[model samples]
Target: MQHLSILPILLPLFSGALLLLPPFSKTLKRQRLLAVLSMLLQVVIGFALVASVQFDGVTQYILGDWRPPYGIVLVADPMSSVMVCVTNFLAFGALCYATGYHDRTGGYFYPLFMFQVMGINGAFLTGDVFNLFVFFEVLLIASYALLIHGGGKHKTQATTHYVILNLAGSSVFLFGLGILYGTLGTLNIADMAQKVGDLEGSVAILAKIGALLLMVVFGMKAALLPLHFWLPKTYSSASAPVAAIFAVMTKVGIYSILRIHGVVFGDDAGELANVAQSWLWPLALLTVVIGTIGALASPTLKLLTANLVVLSAGTLMVCAALGNEAATSAALYYMVHSTLVAGGMFLLADMIARQRGKAEDRFVVAKTMDNPIFLGILFAIAAIAVIGMPPFSGFLGKVMILQAAHSTAEQLWVWPILLLSSLGALIALSRAGTTLFWRHSSSKQASDEKQTIHLGEWLGIVLLLGASPLLALFGGPISELTIDAAVFLHDPSLSVDALLTSPLADGGF
Candidate 1:
């Protein structure tokens, strides 16, 4: 029970190692089987871990039998658990989608995929700031490898820029960590949170500066405005599954912001009240505006790249500005929805490109809806989910954010900007959709022939798209869980009391 937190990190590491063995390399069929089975196991374990956290409130696993403030710790509060589930689900879906494109790459896909999962899970579960950095590096390295896996010129160019920016970000992150450690004398997040406010004078100011610098580093990773130049090029150039996987990578940035601001910085609206309301709010608005404009201007599937960046920015801004229970809940909901929809669209694009032969394969609009009905349906679902249509999870998330924004009616600017950005997203997506599906195909070949959707691809896309509704249905209970999660995050003392007062065997929170 104490070691449950390590399961998320260890499972993926173990799988990656096993897949590298000779036995698993006999054939592509065997590799696919192993990948699916391993990912399914990961998904199951992730859910179990989430359930355990809900039942126990907050579960902490001390490394090497040493207690925290001395040894490393892995904590599973509701926030980390939700992240674990989401990372693993996206990983599994991406891996499944990669099966069709395996021949395009090689035998290295599964191993790298597993390593990517290891990094994401490690970052999510670690309770130490330095370990989080280490995990981030691991994930970034895996992503770099995957970005340039097939070795095309476009991928190479894209990856070069991606690597350069991220490496610089890593340097900034390390410098900030050094400043933080020198000032605080500790790297453990729990201890840092407990002690951060007590420091005085220059040390305290330095700590705040360090936190802000770290935020900038993560903001780049999250594709925040003014630091997001690398995203469109890199995402558009990478393979579909790789781009799909990268879609969730921004969540790492969001997770860091939430953790630092809400937990380490302490959730007093008075302490950093002006900073949150002024600087962060205005910056968020800029991010939303820039991202939407980027989407509108992009001509190809590249537009999704900018659109996702915008979505991430909007979600992060809402979470940062609102900083209420409802805002955090809304951010989490939007994060989950955006990750799924964005990833699905990438995969759908991959399927379309595959059917069309090459990137340069002339754009051919589907004359009969039946010709590309499967992908058409997928595109529609993803588009609607992204655009925040009714009954979908995105709508629910937006409603929560809007409610929070309205609470601060004094800040009259929030609603209009949000509304305009929503309109911008609709227009950008409509144009992209029109170009991809409704526009007449200039190529006569498509008119003379019909392409069939592969059963595996069809199944994967449909199931993935259908998951949005299932998430919506569970919204109520999940919201309750998120509320509990937010409470625990904002005040861990409440969590400690809940855990101690409840019976251990029944896993009561």
Candidate 2:
């Protein structure tokens, strides 16, 4: 039962590796069949892991039987479990979509796709700080490869920018990790939390510095305010399915901020307690304000969605900065909602662009889409969810976040910005939708001339868009679970205890 935590990581890792073998890699059809079955299993295992945590509080698996403060641990509290489950669902949907959309026999798409999922799962499950850095590299490499799977000038250029920026972030990450290890004398996250408050004077000050550096590293990844320039290009140039899957990547930065800030350098960490703490709420507001403006000003559908992703990241960071039980719960809910909606929009934008021919998804009067009814329906769903309208998880998440932040010192600023951003998003999306769908050139191509969106493509978009309501339908239980997760996080000692106490069933490999 404890070992369920490792299955998410292992399933994708082994599956991707096996698929890379000649016997499997030679046949794309077989690979696709295996990938779908593998992902379905992953989704089940992920939910099981989430269930285990809610029932058991914390579930950790130690590698090589080395135990906490020494061994690598994979811990699943409700938060990580939720992320794992959502990631698996998103990957499966996106993978299924990609199958019919892309050339099944072309390049290393399936293998790299699985590896990308593996990296994401590893990031969510690893309990050691250094290993977190390792997983980031793993995911980044896979993304770099996948970004250019079928090359284009824009894609190649965007991939280069994305790679360079991330590599620099990786370097910053390593430098901070070194200082962190030197200050706390440990790399295990729970151990660091256990040890940080015990340090005094110089070591404690250095620890704070390390925490700040790590914050900057994660900040870049999350596209927080001043650090967000790389996003528009990266998303605008990527293929539809690739951009959709990348939606969860930003959440990694949010999760890292929450984990590292809420646990290791938490309120109990002596002088390090408030490290990078002051910036969360204010930066989130600024990010949203800037991002909303950017989205409004964006000239293309791809760019608009990219800007919206930045806006969503800022929204989640508000909770990270609040660092309270309610705020954390709200943040988790918002993460899931934003990821699904944003992913669906990316794919929809891609399909729209393909249908628009040379005009692409530019916010201009262009030819009508091949399937305007299907596209309009899905696009409207995504847009409504993005703007945080009623009857969707976005509305629920915002309500929870707003309610959670009402008493915080930052509320005076937070409330208005969120409200204003939503309004702005509504206006921007309305205009874009009208321009793309309602107003069109008279020289319309025949129905036969439009691009045929494959079943896999529609299924992928539908699954992602459909999840918003599913979240709303299941809101009660999920919220309660997030509150539990938040309580566990608020008291990092629970995580530490769980890591220390988690029994090793396999002994040593």
lDDT of 2 by residue, 1-509 (tens): 65688889888889989888978889888888888899989989988888877776576677876767787878777889999999998988888788775644348788888899989999998889999999999999999988887887888899999999999999999999999999878899888888888888887888888898899999998999789999878987877778888999999999999988788888888878868878776788889998899899999999999999999998888888877889999999999999988998988898888888778899888877778888898888888889999888889999998988756566887788899999989999998899899988878755537477788888888999999988999999989988887888887557664565435223312
Please report how far candidate 1 places residue 48 from its true position, in Å. 1.1
Which candidate ranks first by lDDT, i.e. highest?
2
Backbone clash pairs for candidate 1 read none
Runs in model 1 lying further than 4 Å from the true structure: 268-277, 357-370, 409-411, 446-452, 495-509
TM-score of each candidate structure, all chains considered together: 0.92, 0.96
Model 2 Cα shift for residue 482 (angstroms): 1.2
**Clash statistics: count for each candidate:** 0, 0
Computed on alpha carbons, the lDDT of every model, listed in order, comes to: 0.73, 0.86
**Model 2: runs farther than 4 Å from truth?**
103-106, 446-448, 501-509
